[model samples]
Target chain A: MLEVKDLRAGFEGSEIIKGISLSIKAGEVHAIMGPNGSGKSTLAKVLAGHPSYEVTGGEVIYNGENLLEIEPEQRALKGIFMGFQYPVEIPGVNNAEFLRMAYNARQINEGKEELDPLDFDDILTEKMKMLSMEKKYRERNLNDGFSGGEKKKNEILQMAILQPKLAVLDETDSGLDIDALRVVSDGVNKIKSADNALILITHYQRLLEYIQPDYVHVLSQGIIVKSGEKDLALELEAQGYDWLTPTN
Target chain B: MTTTLVDASDQAESALLNLHKKFMSGNRPPEALVPLNEAAIQRFELLKFPHRKHEMYTFVNTKELVSTVFNLPGETVVSKDFIKSHVYPECESSYLVVVDGILNEDLSDNSAIQSSINLVPLKDAVDQPEIKEYLADTIEKENDVFSAINTAFISQGTLIDVAAKKQVEAPLQILHVSTGSASGNVTSHPRILVRLGELAEFKMIVKYVGVQGNYFVNSVMDILVGEQAGVTFSQVQEDATDAWHYSKTRVQQGRNSRVKAVNAFFGNKITRHHFEAHLKDVGAELLLNSVSILNDAEQVHHFVRIHHEAPHTNSTQNFKNIVNDKSRSSVDGTVIVNQGAQQIFSDQLINNLMLSDNAHADNKPNLMIFADDVKCTHGATVGQLDENQLFYLKTRGLSEKVAKELLTKSFAESIVQTIDFPGVVDYLENTLLKKLEA
Candidate 1:
């Protein structure tokens, strides 16, 4: 469902991720474990086509479509979702309004009938139920005064409502509490199907307990150095990333 | 100096001398600070109108009317039914009215007005020697010629005294309407004096509308909030297309008091002016907001002065302007904190949405603080609507006009978000629709 070949990205002129590649199949959860500044977030942002991160090299193929040249918003329309590590706080924009806009942006690209307010409300209530979230989350300002946990939960709620073919969760667990993490993971799990995929990026083994990835990859410096089954997460959790780096 | 705007004939000399004589005597309205006013007028007469070298009045060129004697029309608006139909009542509180720059019995509702709210016309207040003494000692001003000119004209204005520990039921509305021009230029000074007592709560809306054409309106409103008095003051101006409105407001807030003012200018040829909250005692707060949609050759200039005088003073200043056509706008925000006033928190934000390449907006929001413990922030930005956001909205099914309306609402949400009164919000939205025709 998702493919990346020799992906390289950075901020401005300084390249960070030298060259890296990874792939994930449908219904499979892939965890990218790396230390801070190890390009774990960069991979997600670059795949999502963040304008600040220039794709210095490589192509990202999502469902047989090359997404390197598409706009970040267009990539979202093409069923590519990147849960930002730090979502920008856009004040004065309503949460429901933003979600409706994102949903309609994709619908426009797909040539589908955009839902009206009543229709969108009906859809939203069902998604909120599936995601095990409250209905009031849609009325507040867009992450303006939201707590870290609430912001993360709202991101998952977006993922559930958007229902992208391939969803990437980047550092969604850093700030969430245990209950919020469980709810968010449940939301991610509910959206997964035979034709959908999710990429979980985390430094700890806690989120792995909820999502249970089929494949675990140990990313170091700018590249993924190890690829294995779910057991690699437990080993890495016990030892940590300091032991994975090659000694000079 | 732009004194050269005066004619060279004998008429000019006598006019200048007539101007000096008319401005120098009895210059302070309500007879407030008579000596200071007289001395200030002397200094003001010595200097001519500011020239292009002065950056403060750079975009405001008043060379057209500096030489004209705009007579105050004698046909006073004295119909009681007309006043009752037009002006909102303050019978449960206090209110006053100035008809053709003179306090009229038919215009003001004073007697039977709530005892908690003391409503007195400035002319009648002047007749009371003790009240005149109190005003003459307390009110102060620098040598601003126009303000002093307002004093010399000394027509009439309402004196509203809201008693301490009283909350007025309805908003106190002061309606100032213009009519009947007698010459090339006709002017009227509708003065307003409001003194909200301690711990009292009130909302005052000053509405300015013109019924006739080619008139000049010089209006000033003075508000003094006593300790712990909470007040919300707003001004709505939708003057006639052929009129010019010059309005200035000066307010003083006392200890633990809250004073907020929003000025919405939807008029022709207006120069909106202000000085606010010069003395903020402990825990006193002030909020100033202005919104304008400029069109054609109309020019709107907003001058704001926020001074924090005591510790723990809080203030906010925001003005959103949308300028189209060849219109020009200027916002001059000056915030100052005294040397002894500590822990002052102040913010000034000005945003202009320019709809035409030739339209212009000059925004200067500044702060001067002598205190050490303070939080101050000021910013100004002029930009067209974001193309990405606009395109995104259009693609989402909102038409271009609806999208523009939403964008404008978003731009103004911060100010309206703080407004709690439904009538104010509804009236403002209706006036906005009628003003913009969108």
Candidate 2:
């Protein structure tokens, strides 16, 4: 469903994702683990079409279309979802209203009828219930004054609502407690389907315990150093990224 | 030749004072208001139109207003449909329509609230003790030229008195409509006096609307809240593009009294509002919020002062401005805590969103605290929309324009939501969106 050929992207003039290649088919889950400043989050942002990052040399084809040419909003409508590592707090926009707007945007993209507030409330309630989110989530401002765990849960809740074909979860497990991690993992698992794919970006193998990954890729200094089955996560957790580092 | 030029210039600068003289000469004011009018005229004479160097008028340019000769507007006939179009449906039966600065009894209908409150025209109620005592008591006409001018010509105004401990269920609406004359530019002074007795509760919405032609609306409102009384006052200024609007509102709160004043400015070429709140007793609380959505060459300036004269008083002032095109907005707010007013809590914040490089916003938040152990804070921000916020919304599938509009509206929503009047929030939201889209 997605292919990245020699993806090299960076911010300003420095290269971060250097000559990386990856391909993911439908119904597959991939975990990319790396240490600090290892370009784990940069890859996710580049795929999401963040404007601050410039793609120097790369080609990303999603569903046989040049994904790089699409704008951020168009990318979302085209079924590319990026779970922000740090979701911004918009103090005045209501959470339920924002969710409805996103859902309706996708609906309109697919030539479907738009759901009004009352009609969309049912879908929101169901998705939130599945994610174990409280009713206050429906009324509070979008991520304003929300705890770190609540922000992660909100991202998963968005995933459940939008039902994107491919979701890039960046650092979703970084700030979550054990219980919040379990709940967030359960939400992702519940939404997983045979026609969609997932890319989990994390630094710890603890998240792999909750949601098993089909493939594990170790990233170091802007390049992929190792690719193996899920057991590679446990190996790295026992040791560290030092052995995987490439010597000059 | 130099003497002649100076004389001509001086004559031209005295255009407003000449207009004032013409008004007083042609009309005879009430007997009870003669001394007050005389005092106000003297004050206006001493302090004429404020110059650019004036402290309060630093950012405002009054060259055009000082040069233009505005005639006093006479009573004009207006259609019922016109009045009905501007009246809020919720206040249809309790609204007072003021046309050309005079209360239009035929067009106004206060039958629903006549029993709970005493509503009398200023000229007719001048003999009443409350009217005589509180008419110009709270406002400092000596220091403000506009307030002095408004007081000098306060023949057509309203005096509303609420009985002690009475709760006014219906929200009162004071609709000031300016219908400029075809002959020349006109000006009107609309005065409003509201006196709430002890423990009384009342809500009022004052709106300014103007029709075609060039006009000026100089308005003044003095609100006196007795001990433990609560009042909610909302003002919406939607004058014509060619109109000039100025207002001075003075509020005095007694012990444990509360006042919430919400103001929204959407129209007028040049608009200025002078707002002052005096917390005269302990436990008094004041919440002042204002939002200005300006475009084109429109200019709006707000000068606000909150006085914490008694201990334990609290106040908050939030001013937001959304300026686009070449428009400009300024907010000069100050909170003063007296020496003996200890333990007072005061906060002032000003936020400006500039959508164009040419747009200008001047914000100054000042605090003068003479007491010890008081919590006071002031801050000001002037910037464009947040790019991170924009990207976040855009990634959620909203187009850039929709995202910007939503964010701009959200900036004003915090203040608009505090208004409790029916259909007001919707009106303000729609108006703000329309202005943003334009």
Query: Each candidate's TM vs. the true structure?
Result: 0.81, 0.91
Q: What is candidate 1's lDDT per residue for A36-139, written digit by digit as tens?
A: 88889888778776556788898878778787876666666667777767665544467787678667766777799888878898878887776566677788
Error (Å) of candidate 2 at residue B75 is: 1.9
Q: What's the CA RMSD for each of the models? A: 5.1, 3.0
Model 1 TM-score, 2 decimals: 0.81
Model 2 CAPRI rating? medium
Mark the regions of model 2 whose C-alpha exceeds 4 Å error after superposition: A12-20, A57-59, A134-136, A139-141, A145-147, A174-180, A203-206, A225-227, A232-248, B1-9, B12-14, B123-141
Clashes found in each candidate (C-alpha, N, C closer than 3 A): 2, 0
Clash pairs for candidate 1: B27-B151, B33-B136
Evaluated at residue A236, the lDDT of candidate 1 is: 92
Clashing pairs in 2: none
Residue-level lDDT of model 2, residues B1-438, one tens digit each, is: 768645654775477667667777777677766766777877777876675578888777776776677888876788899888888777889999998778888999988898999987777777877666665553343577888888888766788889889999999899999998777789889888898999999999999998675898999898989999999989999998888998989898999999998889985678999998889999999999898999999999998889999999999888999999999999988899999999999999999999999999998789998999899999999998888889988888888888887888778786787788857888887775578878
Which ranges in model 1 have alpha carbons more than 4 Å from their true place? A101-119, A122-139, A245-248, B1-48, B54-59, B64-116, B127-140, B179-184, B211-213, B240-243, B266-270, B293-298, B322-327, B351-359, B379-408, B427-438
Q: Could you tell me the interface RMSD of model 2?
A: 1.0
